[model samples]
Target: MLRNIVLLLLLCLIYSLEASDSDKCVTVNVNNLNDLVLKTFRPKPCMTVNINGSGKMEILSSDKFKTPLSNTPLAQVRITGGTFSIDPNFFKQYRHSLDVVTLENNNIPKLGYHVFQDLILRQLELRSNNILFLSNPFYNCSIYNLDLKHNKIDHLSDITFSYTRLFHVNLANNSISIIEPHSFPDTVITIQLSHNLLSSIGQNIFSNLFNLVLLCLAHNRLEYINFEKSDLGKLEDLDLSFNSINNLNQAGFSSLRNLKRLNLRNNHIKSISATNLQTSKLKILDISFNFFINFPHASLPESLNVIYVFGNPWNCKCLFDIEDSFSGNVVSNTMDCKLSQIVNAPICISYGGLCVDDRNNTLINAFSKEVSLYSNDCRDLLQNVIFDYEH
Candidate 1:
């Protein structure tokens, strides 16, 4: 009778490991289960399955799951550090019931095809997997937020993210160099492709993203961007900082009707006409750390609130001209730096660019001699450009 009692306790332990229940969910945790121990693992109406990829977790075969997982109403599953392949038939039951799937830290070098297709997941995070390729993985899924950061994906086919409705996507910090046109879904609101190797954008690449609000192409190898071609109508923020952009035209940003912030700091821009930035709703413009001989400050749009021009080779005559231009106009937040006449961004001048504030004290502060940012002549400007800012 004592021998029978020990066998009963062992059976209960295996049952709890394969199937357990709380106030809301029945769960199956495969923390440690071999094929021998798993044959006894009959699942019961479980809502969550946590496969931690620990202790001899091999490729998960649906036939080994004993009962048909094809009918299980799972709501959430976190499969981490596993050498598992996401087979479509394996998650046949979770097509409509799954809410979230997190598959990070798996050290996966490749994601098998047909990933999360036709799944109505609220959130899906496949970050830090060391993945090297992707195609139309989320083909027909209704994902709300998708995060695929820190991968080696280089090319995006036109149908890569062509799902039903994706709200936000972060493909930042990848080796993406080629993106085909219409690669992004129109349902997306925010898309981040920063820190990539993109040198050019395909025609009509972002023209279809009518609902896109924020598009980040920062830290790339783009030499020129013709905003008149894409004309992102609903975009609010544009970050083209840290590139090789050289010039702009009058039709550069004219169609960006709802754009508010433009970050062009740390580029190769020389001069900017006020009409080039004549968007109807622009507020802040950061053209700091560039090569500018002059800025069209006299004709700045009334819709603009602030323009940051730090770390540029502004000619001394232009600095005096800006001071003279704003004195009569409706702009005087600081006595020296008239560009920062906007109330919130008062200390706009820093890392002095132009030389000679009409007093020859070119190496002191930001705007004026008392609150200066390095004012000097051509000799001082050339020395500073070579020594300080020409990274």
Candidate 2:
């Protein structure tokens, strides 16, 4: 019985020793990667985790503790479902692909300059983090898609995407108010900037994004959008709805040659006089829920299949005859006339084009009488009347 008890004690001791050994450091390294890659080697100050008596791993800051090492490479470390803060020097030293970096529901409060700079990453999803400012976030990253949405970023500075090739970026639902020019450099295909406080877009803001196809800026506070005269050459779909666009000048939309669909619903547009509009393949134009005293008379192409000009106070007297004569392929009868009686009036008798207004015959008669009395020789007649008074 004594020998059996001693054997049991030895086994327990051995198990405890094994467990302690297993709780030590684990290094990961990827071999034979490109020399110029950003994350080619293990990041010094990457992380140092200490195991406690209760089997809990505690991460120590660089100033607090040091980690043991055996010349180990760090391409094999898997840190999923755990809390780990990225070292500030991680991207500064190594510049290679950090493939499959998944940090779901992590609280990385602070990030340094060029934190992910010059790295070639396959996927990086830093969703649900409390990261407020990412200065030069992707200084030089070649990422496929970067989703930093749901972060608390407010201001976006210039060269934010210094040298990144981002395919799909979701910056929706943030407090981003100002977007200085050249904020997004290089090629970005799909960009989602919805649900923000972007009031204006300066010229050449989207000029460097040569490969952009889908640009979503809906649900913003944009009042003016002025694009320069360069062909947005590959743009397909653009969403500017749910905004405060009061006046859309010709300069604001000169170079959208390949644009297919445009959503301008729920805006404050009182008129639209488009010049050189036949340059685009616009199939859908939605101008609903606003004021439209005059819409562009430029004959829209036959490719236009849907036009939602409803819920606007359309002047019936001026536009009724024109809309009736128009041969456009699509028309939305939902455009309610503000002035019903004036809409049915003849267009030839009234020369000034006023979208239909209320049938205030008294005001109309007063205006016509003033015009007739002042017709042609009013200045001469005034002089004669003064001369008679002098005599």
Candidate 3:
């Protein structure tokens, strides 16, 4: 009839190109449990499952993932370096069809209560395990990112992420000291808790992180921080860098006031009590290598645009009153002026280490340029000249 209608349209275009390459993703090497139920009969189902480094596959219980991902439609599950012991309803028959679950370098030490109940996950990478205990392991999930970095988690009880909808919670390095008060989950918006072994942090712990925006308590052992009675007020980046914070109470951070990048670098901060210098959206203020000799600079906040105050001990008249209190902002050379020392002229010169102005004794390369305490001359030095820390 026309060569049998062109051979039935070339066999229906080779069965629609083999059903679009069998619906795209279907890798497999599941080792045990009958090779994960023969990959759901391989006509198109599996959507990612690398049961990584499979040897000694110990996925004890949950009926070996209920008949192999019952009605397979999985969308990502790595289970790295196995020795797995994930029971508590091991993904309860792929509830709500998974959407990303890494389970890294396994040896999971703890995690029971509702181990990710009724899932709708969108990322749950349990990094380098040995997790020490964190009760409520996500229930009725709607998770949108929860890493749990380098585990060994110490403590963080109270309703730990109650009724989930998490936005991002890294928990860096871990060995967490403690944090019970409403454990976090006010639709979290970034929470790192860097390094860890937190020395202090209670003032209603973060009162319900009202949409917090980045709060990484860097390298911990924190000496103190009492954010004016909690409720992070939409915090915006507040990394208490390398801690041991010496002093900063004036209401610590006066409820953050939409803070904008305030890292308090290398701590033991000598002082900073201008009633907590309430941040009016501060813009970059590092307070490098602390132990300041003076730094209130008119209680800060004029929307500063970069202020590091190089490694402390500054007292060349408190760096000429922080160059007449941020004359017009932007200044960089990052002082060191040989750690400046001459409180009352004990013969100071310092060049490579800066500071040398005993009334034009010159050598003031305060890093080298970018000065303006009312148009430079290096801010007309000699404000009762001072500087001492040569020890």
Candidate 4:
């Protein structure tokens, strides 16, 4: 009976050893994936699995994590420097506990439909890939932050992120030229679409983004904007610089009552209507390097703390009234014109020699002297006529 007990204890020890080996984190190299099924390379329960190398790996349907047989699921899976074409259900076994998945610097050409379905993934980084189109790949996932920067995606269809609760999405440095209306969820806060080929945007493209705060659309080909239809009531910062915009209407900015900073540098704008200065909460306005010949002083709101109007062909006389009507602390134009000189002359001159007269005096001075001489002659003529009538 003692001998039988010894044999049973030895069997228990072997089982415990196998269990311990199955619950440790595993690192799989693509160079050594010699006909081995992916499920046979599972790490211990609730442990991470890091897949490394640059070779291609096909994740078939039969290949899955061994976490389903155990109580704990995989914690995280990070696949770097590989061309992985994974099936939609490849991660079905670790749906409950997988929190983070990063696939950076990969050659993923496409993602299958419902690829991340039923997973509680919090963050997914798929940067620097060759993804051409963005379909509904992340269905039923509550991803908070998604990074898809430096990809080849050119368009985003409607309801692309309708199934997810995404808050921040970075789609910068892509070839995106079109965005279907309501493509983003209403819960999104910050969206970066800079350095793209977007020549124009739809009127109601951002209509549903009620919680959007920061939107970066710089380095694009946009020539005009219609914010009245965008419904960005809560947006604080808007960057539309480095575009081909030549005009701005009052209706385009009437709805942005909460906007603080507006960047319109490096455009072709020659004028800004006074009605566009209705935003009471605007603090900083950058309109540098444009074709503005006049600065609208009376139209500028008193709430503005700083304004950049440098690198434009500005009329020097426009600065006189800008310095007078504005309370000195409100308008801040970063031009080469000195406010002290402007205050003394009380005349307007163009910085680009547009106001220079033949006598080397400013056109403002010549006009002022002409008005003074004409008034004196009229008074002298009236006195002479009164003397003749009395005689």
- Backbone clash count for every predicted candidate, in the order shown: 8, 22, 3, 6
Q: Candidate 3 on 1-391: residue-level lDDT in tens?
A: 9988899888899999987876576655565533565565452433444454545636556565456455666666665555656777767666666788777877778777888877877788888878888678787688888899898988887676678778888898989998888788788888887888998887888887888777888878998778777888877778887778887774368568888777776677777877687678877777765656556777788887877665455556656656667778864424433224323312123234444323321222331222222223322231101111111
Which structure among the candidates has the greatest TM-score?
A: 4
Worst 10 residues of 4 by lDDT: 382-391
Per-residue CA lDDT of model 2 for 1-391, tens digit only, reads 9999999999999999976665454433222111113233234323222221232232313222212222322221233333345555554333442354444444555455677766776667766666677767676678777777777778776767766677777788777898766677556777788788899887767777777777777778999887655347777677787789888765355477777777777677776656635645877777655566456644565577766654455555455644664555656644233222234322223325655543334433432344244434432221110000000
lDDT of each candidate versus the true structure: 0.64, 0.57, 0.67, 0.67
- Give the Å shift of residue 63 in candidate 1: 4.2
lDDT of 3: 0.67
lDDT of 1: 0.64
Residues 61-93, candidate 1: write the lDDT tens digits. 455443544455667765555555555565555
Error of 2 at 198 (Å): 0.9
Model 1: how far residue 33 lies from native, Å? 8.4
* Cα lDDT for residue 360, candidate 2: 36
Off by over 4 Å in 4: 1-28, 32-57, 60-72, 323-391
Off-target runs (Cα >4 Å) in candidate 1 are 1-72, 323-391
- The alpha-carbon deviation from the true structure for residue 251 of candidate 1, after best TM-score superposition, in angstroms, is 7.7
